[model samples]
Target: MYDHASRPGKPSSKEEDAPSPDKPPEPPITRIPSVLPDAETSPAATSANNTTPASGYAVGGGEDGGDNGGANLRRASTVPSPHFALPLWRKSVIIMITSFTALSVAFASTSLFPLTSEIAGDLGTTPVVVQVTNALVLFTMGCSGFVWAPVGRLAGRKQAWIGASVVFLLCTAGTALAPRAAEEKTRLKIFVAMRILSGFEGTFFHVTGQTWLADIFEPTQRGTATGFFLLGTVFGPAFGPCISGIMVTYAAWTSILWLQCAMIGVGLVSSIFFLPEIRRPGDTERRKAATSSVLGILKEFNPSPVFKVMLLPNVILTDLTCGLLSWSQYTLLAAPRHLLNPRFHLTTPLVSGLFYIAPGIGFLLGTVVGGKFSDMTVIKWIRIRGFRLPQDRLNSGMVSFFFVIPASCLIYGWGLQYEVGGLALPIVTAFFYAGGLLMAFASVNTYCAEVLPKSRTEVIASKYFWQYTFSTAGSGTIVPMIDAIGIGPASTIGVAFVLLGGVLTFITAKFGLQMQHWAQRKGVGSP
Candidate 1:
């Protein structure tokens, strides 16, 4: 019999193997007790009272020991909770407006594809030059978030969002006028410059919107809020081409940019008044202190939550899986024209652009369903285990990873490749594929947000920054990959990635608690 090395006292019973108390608890939401019971302050709260100066928090006058006063402190720590309920009618109106703004910018980002040929012809440039502008814009958008995330951390969310919209509006107007402003050589330069500027400005809708929702909503309500946010993101890309296709057919290429510019103006005005500033008093102080060189200050601010997450092998592996899944998403968006035009022989922009609806519909439904089911499942899991863990949400992605991604890629790829089915078949497959993508995204993104509730804005922003960077790479390489490998092989590779993502997600679900313990043992962030 083989013997293994062990400590003098027969290795402790496996039953005693629970994570140490010093490690931060799993499911960051549950870890933070409901601001502690008002009347009976815990030791943690008492310690905080001694350590935090009077200036550190906003105070409302109350009976010295009143429980209600504690609630006020909690409120001041984040967005000051609205004392009077917002009228449902007004709330709905703002949500719609914000959603439309996000969709319009998103659509502009991708829709210009269908008009590339028409735009190039009018501007007297090769189509390649016209399309290069798209790539440059997207690449710029990916990096812009890194710069904006820190700024949003410093300035309030509403102000940051408005600033981004202002930039976008100016860039859009510039692009609309660029064709007539210069010679063909200079035309490309102007176009590229405008697109890059627009891309940079586009970062606001993603980072600001996400952080804002975190500020306003409680943990339980977050899934629904995230679902709505996903709708804006999903619909923007899905409908961008469809709208652009119609505009280019009926009007000039300049109309697309002009329309976007006008919409930005409207959104900017509405957001300024409607989107409340959600900066906490504590965050305000931190931002002021951080004014001494942004880079140095951001470095000083702890990234322990993010770094500790990486220390868990499963999280790293799972992030890669998410990256690979995103590769197919950007590739599909980038190369659709190639497949639609040649195989279906769809010549008109309207016919080619209509193809987007199949997937867009799927994405919308997936987000709603995924968000609800993930929340329900998380609640059920907590009951059964008699304990809650943040990794529970990671399990929600398993269904999407194992079934939706691979099946959708294979069917969508093969359907277009052989032209073996009716238009409806491809459309249905596209919808399912999109649904899976959004469902997976809902889980993956929420996991990031929930795992670091205290540093919610930076954590959420960091995730998007990295995710969009993957999107940039996928968008850039899609044409080449499709050209070299052809659709069938390219999709097969995507399917393999989906499988890998599933395996890693399972690891996160099962061993995440243990990993949290290991991080603490290795001296990670405070509990």
Candidate 2:
């Protein structure tokens, strides 16, 4: 097994990962797996002579939790080789398919809403018992983030996707078909297990899809690509409940899961035929050096890498910021159904469902525009500095984080308290707040890949790790919190979270590179 054996002592400044401004920025994404004596002198080392090191060669980190200097082994486990140089049209297609898959998974996450009672009746249990399953599914999705990368590294990226899809399909089927002929206890247990298992596939799609898009696009254009890719994620949750609400009115509650199954089928079929392999590097020695056995990979598989990644100042701080943002994001999303129906004497599920559309539109506009602006910022920064750093793009999303989200959060929360603008004003605030949320999400999502490109999978996965954790907390507590303190106080709490997150991101944008450089010296990340 490859090990990130740390160098014995603090190294000189020259040993730091920071590159000279005059020289072209070394691709920081991937590396050669084993630090072998004869490896660099071998034929493979000679080949990388012509291309970019980090991006061009397409290496990945090992299961042991650090960069292994390995260029992709066969597109070794998902690192897209720049040598392949896919066409723009082909890359767009890849992004589209992955985005659709992400959307489908996002849909699955929430489509069961308002059906808890119906499902519980079938299982001879209370709606409350069935509803807890939703939270568990969400929790499971977050937990699964840690698994996707290691399994991808061990099996191959394509295989990992296919395997997760297959498992998800089977689990969905099980959840949907909980054996009505069986006893209630038995049926409920089967349904619960299957639903939880299906959760495993959700974050894998969301986080890994981001990394996959990163695999194909360069840093200069990744924000735009990521923004487009986020369409599925941003819209899925918004539409899922609406569609499910309408569907349950007309069809079986299980029909929602069945519909989700059909969507997953479409995505799976598209991927099976069209999703390109991350192609391996050209040299024979490089392939040999990058290769590893599945058993060996699993033996060394330590899930701690996800946690260890948090130790980095940039990662943890940005993640902390993301955590706070998520607290507000979920709060906004969860608030509407609770706020809208009672406030205006709106009784129908459909009417409450309509409220989600406001944020959905905001999410759409925010992602598309935010993505473009982030890329624009990257190009502007590169032109000014003569090179790009991962943190350069963070400045683009600051408007959303600092001004847009905070302001919108306060307005949305307080408007309901004082009955300020009726429903119209609150809907508008929801739209902007949701927009601000995705805008920040787009920036941070792309940054995860660049921050530790070699360990791109882990970095991205771990971000979701913290993101889901905060989101779950917000969803679980916000309604009760509001009931106790009123919407005004609840929103004030959310705004506080937004401001703190904003300050943290500002710190990162300004000093993240220095923090990352210091972490490299301390072996904090794979830098």
Supply candidate 2's per-residue lDDT for 358. Answer: 86
How much lDDT does each candidate structure score?
0.65, 0.73
Off by over 4 Å in 1: 1-98, 292-318, 523-527
The worst-scoring run of ten residues by lDDT in candidate 2 lies at 34-43
Tell me the tens digit of each residue's lDDT in model 2 across 284-311.
3433434555455555367777778788
What is the C-alpha local distance difference test score of candidate 1?
0.65
Residue 263 displacement (Å), model 2: 0.5
What TM-score does model 1 achieve against the real structure?
Answer: 0.78
Weakest 10 consecutive residues, lDDT, candidate 1? 36-45
Residue lDDT tens for model 1, 1-527: 10111123454223234457897544311112222111111111222144243322322213432222221222123333451145655545555666667776777778787777888887778777767778667667655655665556667667677778888888888888888865887776787788888887664576566655655554555566677776877788887887777877788878878888877788888888777776554777777777768575675444454444444444555556556666667777777777778777789788888888888788788887887777766666545432234667677888898998789889988876676786776788888888898788777766655554555455454455455667777776666787897887777877886787778777777765445444545655331
> What would the TM-scores of all predictions be?
0.78, 0.81
Error of 1 at 158 (Å): 1.6
Number of clashes in every candidate structure? Answer: 1, 16
